[model samples]
Target: MFRPLELFIGLRYTRAKRRNHFISFISLVSMAGIALGVTALIVVISVMNGFDNELRSRILGMVSHATIEGVRDSVKDWESALAKAEKNPHVLGAAPYIEREAMLQGQRVAGGLVRGILPGEEPKVAEIHNKMKSGKLTDLFPGGFGIVLGRELAYKLGVDVGEQVVVYAPEIRATPVGAVPRLKRFTVVGVFEIGMEEYDSGLAIVHMDDARRLYQTDGPDGIRLKLDDMFRAFTVARELAAELGGLYRVRDWMQGHANFFRAIAMEKRVMFMILSLIVAVAAFNLVSTLVMLVTDKQADIAILRTLGASPGTIMGVFMVQGVVVGVIGIAIGTLLGVVLALNLEAIVKFIETKTGLVFLSPDVYYISDLPSDMQWSDVGLIALLGFVFSLLATLYPAWRAARTEPAAALRYE
Candidate 1:
């Protein structure tokens, strides 16, 4: 219900030359603060999003989307499980695996998780073939006793391709002397690096038959499954578990790594809240700016009141001015945030090139470069919050302006 006269006067006051230069300086500072806060928030959130995606891909590369295992020691009928899983419309592939904890000794001794897999069927459920740094996944034939080691695990055991390592299984064998740990010497056929410390430092791969002989298991311990959509893994696992009639236990990637993802999500929320305070502080600065503006225009307010302008009209004029200032700041911030987030990776690369500095190195970190994935929804939410804070800041100052009495304000004149 604002009149054109009020709008025109508000805009004129905003653009007119100000007597107090400090007010103008403070206004500029507030705008810059808002812009900086928004830019940082957007860039940080985008980087986090990129990191989340990268970690997910690398993890899923080594692990399956879902897994089905017998409630007992081993799945004696794993072939049946694999066949049943493959029949599901949502299942893309399935493979059987046996895993055990063992001590591996080359020149040094190190403990690692020993996983047994079928070379022919491994690629259907996992991407181990693509991650091989040396040797082929098919090199491990039955009775060959060939093993594949993760890069860090190989380093820890001081063994490489064509080298020999002794794997001391947890199983016990009664020998002529006494009960001894069953051990076997295996040739290192391959080395793979998944870049994650947990897997790279503690995982070993060998033929399924060799693992069964070493562990004395009748069959594979579990069946791994790949789904058409990884996000539906939990639901698919539940259905598969039900179809198997409670004989097997089912799990999905999310359940296995819930803590890892939950931590990341919690960190993102905390970061958002912390950055929002910056925008809030800048928005609240509008209070001081408008208060000073109202004081400076006391005589003007009196003139308008005496000229038949209602208190509500006077309030609208000042409100418009404050809103204009906030809108301008918010608009500039939104523009800068979007631009900076989209170009953050390139900007980081440019800085590294110019400064001869390496922010991330593949030798030391999983990700070797800065990554960004700007989401429009995040941008929209930030912009909306900024606008709401700005609007709230205008209220008190506008109300004070409306309370000005014509007689008292004009007395000084």
Candidate 2:
């Protein structure tokens, strides 16, 4: 259990009481700065990770991984397309859908995108069945003219389940007066909430047959496919399109939402680089602290050198001291960050409830609560970076201390 002389001396120097109280205060401040920086980086990164997961799961859950659309704007033979898509090993589920822009007039009027879905097959492709807030997806029936509205959309229209609404299709019919918009009255059979304002306030669903009748189409506009791995959606869609051939076009979720995720990624990187500056600044403080320490202990260093201590050993002593400070700060910060990240949702909720202040609104942010997903890998990386910065900061001051002229230093004494 023998320790290196340099390590022993470093530990003693770190623990020794300084005659200058300001130097000790600076040392404390440096440690606090590092701890603050590490904590911020961990918490922010974890929240970003949480947002990424939430966007992927909630958005992908409600939409298809890939879509096969007809070059003609309507897939006349969707059944065959569905069959072909399902035959692909990458595809986990496939469902036929017809989507169009429509206007709804209830207590109020609003415009939205309406999707036609089969009640039985819809659950396999989308999570609407599990996302119901008031009514069941089964409420949608052929020839019933029943429609499912998103919660926010329903709220905006002032309509609820079992209420009636008039739908105006984008298609125009020739009339005696002029071209009149095709319109129909429908019963609101179900309501759903997917926690995304864009989807919730701008989308509605109807039975496949009802949609076809309303749009005057014989079949679905396209087949939506769910893949085993969503990240591979683009590749799978391309391969499927090539396999199917002949006027079949493929689209993936990423194509539509690439910018959104890209923004998140870019913001995460910028925030990381920005927050890392805090650690860097604190590491620079360590250099200042060690330089002052070297100046204060010049006589001691000279005595040690005269007693046969090597310059390398002197450098090792200061390096060990700086590393000790960094390790302690990193450990404390990591523990605090993990605790905060793990319970971030609850903590935010509690704060909101107590202060009667809303951080996120369902109508604005799509999500109503803060989310956090701590990754040990991110924590490890932050800790390692802090250590490296601290070690680097120690080098110049330690080298200066190592190169001290013993004869000159003791001659002043």
TM-score to true structure, per model: 0.92, 0.92
How far off is residue 156 in model 2, in Å? Answer: 3.1
* Per-residue lDDT of model 2, residues 1-413, tens digit only: 89999999999999999898887887888888888889989999999999989987888878899898878768776777778889999889999999999999999999999899999998878888998998898888999999999998999999998899999999999999999999989999989988877888999999989999999988898888898998898899888778777687788998888899899899999999999998899877899888988888899999999999999999999888888888888888888888999999999999998999999986577777788999999999999988999899899989999999999999969
Tens-digit lDDT string for candidate 1 (299-338) = 9999998999998889889888877877788788889878
The window of 10 residues in a row where model 2 has the poorest summed lDDT is 72-81
TM-score of 1: 0.92
Q: What C-alpha lDDT does candidate 1 achieve relative to the native structure?
A: 0.89
Off by over 4 Å in 1: 1-8, 307-309, 361-363
What Cα-based lDDT does every candidate model obtain?
Answer: 0.89, 0.89
Model 1 lDDT, residue 325, Cα: 78
